[model samples]
Target: MSLKWVDVQEIAIQLVDSRPGVDPRFVNFVDLHQWVLALPEFNDDPRHGGEKVLEAIQAAWIEEAD
Candidate 1:
């Protein structure tokens, strides 16, 4: 499935798998945004994501990490 910025949960899951042992809690939004854009499955407007979306992804990633 194509991933947009709104697919925060899926993005988080992918991040968790791609970045093992990395702590999402300490990640900045800028890096997170770049990381999401770098995902092979991600296909959406680069300008679509905002701080809120990034936060949601981070939260989901943190949860997945646990």
Candidate 2:
């Protein structure tokens, strides 16, 4: 099933509170960007998802494109 906006926000909050893979505090969006960068697809291109984690991994989507 597709996630609701609430679900997405909750996911973002969780990303902030817990370590999605490394550490919590995603610190800055840059940290989040770094995490994303370490991923295969993102590593291929730091701008793979454009700018936001939401957009980068939104059930295969992001919040912003650039």
Per-candidate TM equals 0.95, 0.31
Off by over 4 Å in 1: none
Q: Pick the candidate with the highest lDDT.
A: 1
Number of the top TM-score candidate: 1
Candidate 1 residue-wise lDDT, 1-66, digit = tens? 899988888999999999897899999989999999999999999888888889899999999999
RMSD (CA, Å), each prediction: 0.7, 9.3
Q: Could you tell me which 10 consecutive residues in candidate 2 have the lowest summed lDDT?
A: 57-66
Clashing pairs for predicted structure model 1, backbone only: none
Off-target runs (Cα >4 Å) in candidate 2 are: 1-27, 40-43, 52-66
Instruction: Give me the overall lDDT of model 1.
Output: 0.92
- lDDT score for candidate 2 against the true structure: 0.41
Error of 1 at 41 (Å): 0.4
- Tens-digit lDDT track of model 2 for 1-66: 333323435444444434434433234456555644444322243454354444534433223211
Go through the candidates in order and give each one's C-alpha lDDT. 0.92, 0.41
Clashing pairs in 2: 54-62, 55-61, 55-62, 55-63
For candidate 2, what is the total of clashing residue pairs?
A: 4
TM-score of 1: 0.95
